[model samples]
Target: MKYQEFFSITIEHSYFSGGPADLIVYPEEKTRKLLEKQGFLLKRTGTGIKVLLPMRDNNRVFPVLTADDLFAFHVLPTSGTVREFTDISEIEEDNMILFTNEGLDIGTIELIKSETVKEEVFQNFPALAKIEIKGNQITTDVIGTPPVYKAIFDSKSIKWKYYLLSKSGATDIAVETRGDQLQFNELEIGNNSLDPIITSLRLNFPDTKIAVFESSVAIPLSSKSIKDIKLIQRDSVTQTDSILMKHLPNPSIYDQGIQIIKIK
Candidate 1:
């Protein structure tokens, strides 16, 4: 299998609400070959290739590479009758992928920014490999027998940030500015639950607006000021199953999956 067979990139039509292309594009032969090796059927009409629907029955057409996506795939189109192909010259420099292995396979895919690889083949890589899939991005390092936790707080200026005495699991926190208020967009608790992280964050930034993502009813927190907490239902069909297939081995440390919370 070629290096590119280990992965494919996709974005939903919602990603581009402006317009759709009119060209009968075929993802340059190399890209088509790679995707086909991975079980993707490149639908061909009598005279032209057709676009496949984006996953999850989305309205957007996916797999059509822009200049940047082509650079990430490290392919240049030779000659094509297609009117909407991504020209190699238009590719952004930063969009190029740097693979650890010469023949980029699943175990050697270098995670850069927000990119995904074949989930089923991901476990062959080291446990410490940083992986970003769906809304979750995790990287782990071994410490003692169990892994220690590293807290990632998302804020411009947290009152007083403190390093963790011990690490637990990889945690993700995202905050976005909402007018004058700092809205905690999302929080994925570590393996140890919300107590430790919440305590530490509260200690650092006492009274700040925050929100937690939760599936069930809100659990009362000691901080009465954290009343902005919002309860959200978990996706009935989550990408977790795809990313964390039982066949794929997890790191030694326990993972708390993800959770949400809010404070104001």
Candidate 2:
């Protein structure tokens, strides 16, 4: 019910191959509460209380603020811990989840990043709404609807969605009629992590038609499911419906980047 329940800040670095901290700890009141719910309990020390993992017969000693030293934000190996900071001090991260409202038992959560409430995102569609949560309360600064980076009208929307979602950050894009005045309409959210290259992507999906929009997302031709794909242009480039038979590392794009794959 608290803001801390839905969000935590942590920095992720893939370069830490050497010895890393078993935990990245920034013990806050809300964080402590969550940990308690996760089976951590306080033991009476000589002078005060200390957060420790519930003792197991195996003598597994879990660490915390008073337990041990820790790194920024690495998985706990056997398990993972949340990395909440007192301030936004980290500079970089990859595919980190800032906030999520899943399993909250609430229908909708209006998250206002600014100081004044303006709009609420409903099912990825921005709409006017009231800002009220169970225990989370904050201000917001919303000038208007999210700005659209690029648009694809009645016949061209996938390219913009396909392109913007491929990158990180909230793509401030709008899909609407031609207006140089820079007005925006409804918007949509994208995947949390950037899509991987088609080749590196595991074809664990059903044997059905899959649409892969042409962005920088690439794949290899190792899978027999993908014999050869054609490149079609939907972006506002030199051609609207240009087609070219190309293989991996060169396929421009197809209509919505449709790849007919019969995954084995």
Candidate 3:
């Protein structure tokens, strides 16, 4: 099974902005032919396999499908532009706002994650020349007179698990602007605390807010993000007033008590 990404866009279409129209998907020659022969209108763009939905709600999620699975596509008049998703990692803290296809910028949305952040050094960000990743840290350099950029991701299992447990207790996660990106490390669940890794961007920028989430009806659960596999716990850890589920090959390890199992 393969997972495909899809974005939900809502629009109150009008003559000024754009008229209502169906969405086009599956632009590939072979795929389009197959789908067309099967009585379906579809297309794919250079960026990705198009699977457009009618404008209604605003949200983002990667859709899952098998290679042979065909998505129902309704071909309609192509209207409006796309505010392009630059990358899955991070974007300019300010540009994270919800924007319209026709250059309409809404107010900033909450930060998706407390770990990743990026910013421009000067007027026009230069093209990337090289990128190097070491462990949980990433280093990138642009073509000519631009400063180096750095990003840090916590790979340690115990620390981040503990951090999530701590932050879930009706507290706003605070990730301050240390150098260029947001950094935080007090995520330890063991007797010997692990060291926190903080990376920096050489340029100077204003301090941005990266919080956990707004205090509301949101309920936190002991689940890991599909993008990150480091949060999977194979062993038991101390939990004062929290829930921890085992996500290992051998489930229900707690019933067997703590064992000295080796990992590769």
Candidate 4:
């Protein structure tokens, strides 16, 4: 029933490559008791110990102990002989160290970065979020009944809007649609200028029908071909009244943006 039992950790010999770990060990009852006494709740899941430590600003979560931390403990056998240990306490301030049950230093856990968390969120919940990168702007949409969109357009400009699309950039050709309104800036284009953009949109949404409208001009598209085009307008609405609704689709568009959107 402990948190560690709910989760598991595996140490690999190589990261980003396929290699088995030299040693793989799990927390014993004694180790769990020690961590529990220190206010760490352990949950046992199929993956490994889900160790929930008290939230501290500097604390981080790592799935495995690192080689550097292992060096300090000096791997010793179950026998009486002791192994030579390295003095890593001097660099301890720069690293986070974790110990193994056998009294050996396993490794230092690396700090979890924001990018890593974003990737994890996308990978694990691919249907619930949308990740988009255009030029220097990074936009994410966590769409549902009450959709939430987070955008990091620039390091200095970070904003979140609820049910509204905001515009930026010169000429404001970059259009974002939210709620019941579509907004754009400096909209001046002819057939040639809109063709590539419409083609890109068709390429992005191959499964859905695309209709581009500019004033009284409406172009219904069924194929992926770009010819003469000017201004382009793109919008998506989920069809809720289709006879094939069950087989219609899942939220897969966000995967193109490296995000996942989960709707409850």
Candidate 5:
């Protein structure tokens, strides 16, 4: 035995407006075959339907079906202009239009539009040359005579690094550089005091934000808090922090306590 699920069906009709002359009923597979024998073709895709029909003067295609009262008709061409069919019970008359044939050829339209935009941009900016897109970075090379201008694709690269560190659950620290600035979200200290860490960081970065967090209440060395050090409270430090801080500048601690100090 097979179980069957009951479902309701809703019919949709194509019409420009709710008018007495715009009522249409689409043909079923059998009816479509009968119409095809008389000289009409129906093309259907996953999304839409198309109908092709012949006329007295020339052939025409209607992409939509229309209903008029108790009669259904396809759009046809009149003279050189296309118009909707108003006659009913004339399925043998080739007047219906298929949507698949009337709509803009999507592939060709996209190609043309893309080409047009590229050409327009190139023409407007004569200096524009090659464009390179990598992940979130976009680099565009501009044509120049002697001096080439290389610009950083994104200035937010530095800001994104902080977000990445936070997501990775990594301890953030501020490391001063000779030319570059190292910023972190959290830092861990070992046997050393916070004062030395600040001193070392300031010697390097001179301007950087370093935040520190520890599990226990560690007393920081007796010195003015640097402008770049920030201390917070954490439950504990991982072994990695302890090992890595050894190579870090000025990683000294006076005692175990919560201290937020900035080294400048």
Candidate 6:
């Protein structure tokens, strides 16, 4: 069986400073089909929900940042006077907004509202022959500028397991057993001593051949059944209080009790 990835999104749409629509609008049929093609399946009746399934083990996913490019239907009626410019020079002479459908400014709506040219505005523009604009004339030779496209991947979510153990009472330790090894992933001691916890764990799991303790505790157990005690400590030397757990197949032999070797 595979686990489901659950997520939710809330969208507030506005255009031209109009108040947002009162009702929550569902995605159009075409948009839903596009998302389905990209492995995002939406609910049959719900809004702003996607049901993700684990199709592969290492599959990664991210969240969409902006929906500014998504299409929406709009209705407006207007009439404008038509004028023609004979050449690029004529258009530049007017000092009007230089608009383009193909080169450099594709997919963006830029309004050249002022003569005060901003350097960053043209940072990605086709290189200019000259930087200075003389008397409403762009004194730059035109080059074959390519269209600009940008994609950003900024957010991702991972599945994790967390346990919040209270420190005021018994230390909470979580472990997994495979074969003869008892592997602990996390151990939190609030106010209790490590000795009682290890003693209880040994009694509870008497058949465990090897005790793998992943935490700050280096306290050796009294039970001889635990022949090999592997302590996961951050440094080679044990701290006054702390535990770490890294795995190893063959444990070292030490007559003094618990053996700790820092991972190289």
Top lDDT hit? 6
Higher-TM-score candidate among 1 and 5?
Answer: 1
Model 1's number of clashes is: 14
Per-candidate TM-score against the hidden true structure: 0.16, 0.17, 0.15, 0.19, 0.15, 0.18
Clashing residue pair totals per candidate (backbone < 3 A): 14, 15, 9, 35, 38, 8
lDDT score at residue 55, model 4, on the 0-100 scale? 39
- Off-target runs (Cα >4 Å) in candidate 1 are 1-28, 36-39, 42-111, 114-179, 182-264
Q: For each candidate in the order shown, give its overall lDDT on alpha carbons.
A: 0.26, 0.27, 0.24, 0.25, 0.26, 0.28
**What lDDT does model 1 reach?**
0.26
Model 1 Cα shift for residue 15 (angstroms): 10
On residues 1-264, what C-alpha lDDT tens digit does candidate 6 reach at each position? 243443322221221123222222244444456455545554422222233433346643333323322311111111110011011122243232222112223233221222222222122332111111111211112442211211101111111122222223223223333353544455333434365545554466444322234523332222123333333223335334233333332221222223322221
User: Which runs in model 2 stand beyond 4 Å of their true positions?
Assistant: 1-30, 33-106, 114-229, 232-243, 247-264
220: Cα error in model 1, Å: 33
- Collision pairs in model 6: 167-190, 214-245, 215-243, 215-244, 216-242, 216-243, 217-242, 232-244
Task: Estimate, for each residue in 21-85, the C-alpha lDDT of model 2 and write its tens digit.
Answer: 23222333454565566465533322112334454564533333321221111112112211221
| Order by TM-score, highest first | 4, 6, 2, 1, 3, 5
Q: Model 2: what TM-score?
A: 0.17
Alpha carbon RMSD to native, model 6: 24.9
lDDT (tens digit, per residue) of candidate 5 on 1-264? 221111111112221122122122234444456445535554432222333345434422222332211111222111221012121222223222122111223222110101111111121221111111111111112421111111111000111111011222334343332332333433443435456655675567544544453322222222222243322223355523222221232232322222333332
Whole-model lDDT, candidate 6?
Answer: 0.28
lDDT of 4 by residue, 60-107 (tens): 332333332211111111221110111222222323223222321223
Per-residue lDDT for 1-264 in model 1, tens only?
111121323211111233222212234445556455433454443222322323434322224333322211211112232112122122243332121222222332233332223222112321111121211111122321211111111111112111222122223322222241323334444545556766666566554433343222211111112222222223345522111111111111012323222311
